[model samples]
Target: MSPLRLVIRLTAVAAVAVLVAACGGAQDPDVARVATGLLDAVDSGDGAGACALLAPPVRTELEDTSGSPCAEAVLEEDVGAPSDTTEVEVFDTMARAVVGSETLFLSRFDGRWLVVAAACDPVAGKPYDCAVGMP
Candidate 1:
């Protein structure tokens, strides 16, 4: 093959590899499972279920809002499931997931992986209070 053609082919192959890696082509099964379960719980409006999957700090925050109006509103909204193509990154004791424009950070606590924080922009219809409270 001509040098230019060879270069083009190599570039195409490299691009595909990068895309696969970015999407976690061979993600750890356990991590994938946890991430999926958490998202499913949140999507289903299972606040208690979702709370169970949160780290101590985050869970405490949620529990603190026992009689808050925000909590009631969140329970009523019934936020739908995240997009199908959520991305998860797993580390030894920490993981980050990107669902749409929001990013969730999780940490392994005790014997389970639980979400600790979520990123959101207030101006974008997602206030910090809502993100921290809901997620």
Candidate 2:
């Protein structure tokens, strides 16, 4: 396969593995708090705050995808502000949160868990398809 396609396939596999690991596992409290903070920022329309909490790559991807800065695109993202911060699942520095049916993925940096992806849905027998973030 092409190099780019190979990378995409690998990324998809990793995403699926992470989500699968989250099933029936213990959720971390600190991770859950950070995830909630992100959702709260989005719900409150604090675009800058939400953008600040995104992982560097996620922010970069948002800017690239929107052709605008994260501060601007974060608000304009079609994925609605997340709610129901429950059933959080953490695997080392990476985490997944259930926010009103959408899974929000996070990673830790500088001792803080920043959102790596949001508004993700796993297609049965396929990789996750995310709306507002990247793998």
Using TM-score as the measure, the top candidate is 2
lDDT by residue (tens digit), candidate 1, 11-129:
99999988876666336555445555656776776666665665666656655655443333335433335665667777567666666555666677786766676533436565343
List runs of model 1 lying over 4 Å from the truth: 1-26, 65-80, 122-130, 133-135
Q: What are the per-residue Cα lDDT tens digits for candidate 2 across 14-86?
A: 9999887765345567666767777788778888998888888899899998899888888876444566646
TM-score of each: 0.55, 0.72
Candidates in order have lDDT scores of: 0.59, 0.77
Q: Model 2, residue 129: what's the lDDT? A: 79
Supply the TM-score for candidate 2.
0.72
* Clash totals, every prediction: 0, 0
lDDT top scorer: 2
> Alpha-carbon error at 113 in model 2, in Å?
0.6
Residue 125 error, candidate 2, Å: 1.4
